[model samples]
Target: MDVDFTFRKPIDVSVILSTLLDAGMRSSTEGREVAYLVDEDGMFEWRTAAEYQLNEVMRELGDPRWNDRVVGMTLFFAEAETGGDFLFHPGRESMSCVVGINPKLFQGSSRFCDIGWYLANLVPLLEPLGLSEIEARDSP
Candidate 1:
């Protein structure tokens, strides 16, 4: 399906990223995982991960249900070396989206691919749900 990522405002991508990380970490299934992304030039860069800052922000966000939810259905780490459009799929619960927080990886496989998948798909959904965009200071 053709997924829509329209947003009301320009959200600080980093903040949303950190929130996902915090939620993932708090769940305890994964201690810490960094989201990876592929740039225009096909370069890999590290995005955000579960860290002290994300935890603090999560605490401030103060939504137990939000943390509990996976935001989307199935999140995975994928690398399209050939370069193609992002793939969007359905999840068991509501929906699924992937975010490439980190840069693209040209060589070998990306270890942070899991987080990358989440960021690429979920970030756009944040605004519609009444979530505020990250501020300048919050963005990395």
Candidate 2:
């Protein structure tokens, strides 16, 4: 499934990165689940809030189509072995959680459900961090 969420107010890239990192850290401590930063070379590396440079990452991994606009910033955060990924594009005011391949190629996978559950709980956490007017969309 293709899950998309939009925040109420425009958020800074640095703030978004920090919030996600904080969430990752909390999840890690709780032993629930943690997200990793997937780079352009498909490397899944764990990064802390201080390690992320939004501009640098965007330039290295972001889609060229969005290069001209701030909206091109794309950060892929995936849960280990879940086949789930949260694609954060702060510039677009949206984040997408996807599992397996696109709907056109596959019906959907268990990973989708796993990520769905993760995102469901995450939304609440994000609200306290400054996200509001949250809206979710899933592909049929």
Candidate 3:
């Protein structure tokens, strides 16, 4: 099974990334994407976050949870490697979007992936700037 979340607006990818790092969540520090089609050769090799800050990672190993929920499904592939058509599934426009946040956002993934943490943290963290209210979903 696969899971993902969606936002009402375009979020600051940087903030999310920095937040993940700060919260100590772990994903892939590298992905397979082209930051700018013209800047580099059209190659989809494993590239570090620095290679494409355009979207997503850092480096660590931890499953953050909130209120007995898992923040992420824990995939070995990089976010960019997810697919070119982000949030878009085959023959569909909505894909399982993976927005990796730090485990701290969920108050540590030791067990639960709680929404409360998002309310307490993500809200104040983004609401002020109007970047909150992302909904999570589970898909097969």
Candidate 4:
């Protein structure tokens, strides 16, 4: 179920950024399913036509809820822009390609408490992608 495997290498960050950007662009235009990868370090990076940085992604595999349940790791998604800045966003349907775990986990919770738990963990984990901090709309 792993979408793709991203080993830590010199191009690891750029590779991830490019894939996601390409996928996002395709989704924005031609409508295609996106593919991404994460390493054990929680480096959630992707790519498309350009490189991006996802140093801030969280690691859900280590969570108590998933200690034995989920394998692999968590990663953040990001994109680079023309201005040399990066933009991070909550992973949308497009950025996420699921594997190993139940896809249902991604669906929003009906219970307010469950939703709160989901976002609380998700926010800090995803903060490193720095989506909220960067306005990478210019596109890389």
Candidate 5:
């Protein structure tokens, strides 16, 4: 579940990341998700790099227990375990909309959250990052 929000001002997702981490919202994050184009199909066909940056081998191997797939992109400011897997748009600037990935599987896990939640909760948290520009809260 991705919650899209229209921001009144330019926003750099990386800055949001740093701010959240600094606030202990996320335990840690070293860098952005390492993306690898997995295919050219109708799908987005990309996967974040594994621990060894081995997106190819890991995808090929397809072993679940390996913990090698960078589970929800281990390096991201993703709280997959807490239903706050906020997606990062690397290098994006001046975007009118940003989707906040939210899963409704309960806070102890990944996926759906919203503008109601995104704005009310995230806006304040992001103020220190010099942004609180979300214009309105609505479901897409």
Candidate 6:
């Protein structure tokens, strides 16, 4: 499912990284491993808190397609075991995050564009992660 949620404000980069790490740990405890996406290459290095400088990675992965609106934004985080990715956008007004499922995993009539099922599975997982302020919406 395609879901979008924004932070209440422009939160600190450290906080964002910490939150993502915490989520990954929690998922691991539940048998679902999550990791930060390093690059499009096969290099899937698991990073430690001390190893990452969010701003640096953001700069390296900046997407110009956003027209400078989301400078330093990066779509470089994903589940290590599963096949989904997270895109983080630190906009001037707020910060947004997206979680998407890999389409290649589905096929034939089973391939559906609607993200209702994905949202249903994700909302509860994120609720306890101190993201209550996030306003989430399902995109078409």
lDDT of 2 by residue, 44-116 (tens): 3544332334445433334444422333122333343333455656364666555543222223653224445
Candidate 5 ranges with C-alpha deviation above 4 Å:
27-43, 49-80, 88-118, 128-140
Q: Once superposed on the true structure, which residue ranges of model 4 sit more than 4 Å away at CA? A: 1-94, 97-113, 133-140
Alpha carbon RMSD to native, model 2: 8.6
- The best candidate by lDDT is 2
Q: Candidate 5 clashing pairs?
A: 83-109, 102-111, 102-112, 102-113, 103-111, 103-112, 104-112
Compared with the true structure, all predictions reach lDDT values of 0.33, 0.45, 0.32, 0.27, 0.39, 0.40
Clashes of each: 28, 0, 13, 16, 7, 0
lDDT of 3 by residue, 38-59 (tens): 1122232233334344343321
For residues 2-109, what per-residue lDDT tens digits would candidate 1 score against the true structure? 123433443333354454444442222244542333222333333444544444433433333343222321122323321112221122112223333343432465
Better of 2 and 6 by lDDT: 2
Global fold similarity of model 1 (TM-score)? 0.29
lDDT tens digits by residue: candidate 5, 1-140: 34333344545444544455465554223443454332324353446543354334334423333222222221223344333444323222222223433332334434334435445546566655455334543343
Regions more than 4 Å wrong, model 3: 1-10, 29-129
How far does residue 70 in candidate 3 sit from its true spot (Å)? 25
Better of 4 and 6 by lDDT: 6
Model 3: lDDT to the true structure = 0.32
Prediction RMSDs, each to the true structure: 13.8, 8.6, 12.7, 17.0, 10.5, 8.7
Output the number of the TM-score-best candidate.
Answer: 2
Better of 3 and 4 by lDDT: 3
Candidate 6, residue 63: how far the Cα is off, in Å: 16
Error of 5 at 56 (Å): 19
Q: TM-score per candidate, in order? A: 0.29, 0.44, 0.30, 0.21, 0.39, 0.39
- Measured with C-alpha atoms, the lDDT of residue 68 in candidate 6 is 29
TM-score of 6: 0.39
Q: Could you tell which candidate, 2 or 6, scores higher by TM-score?
A: 2
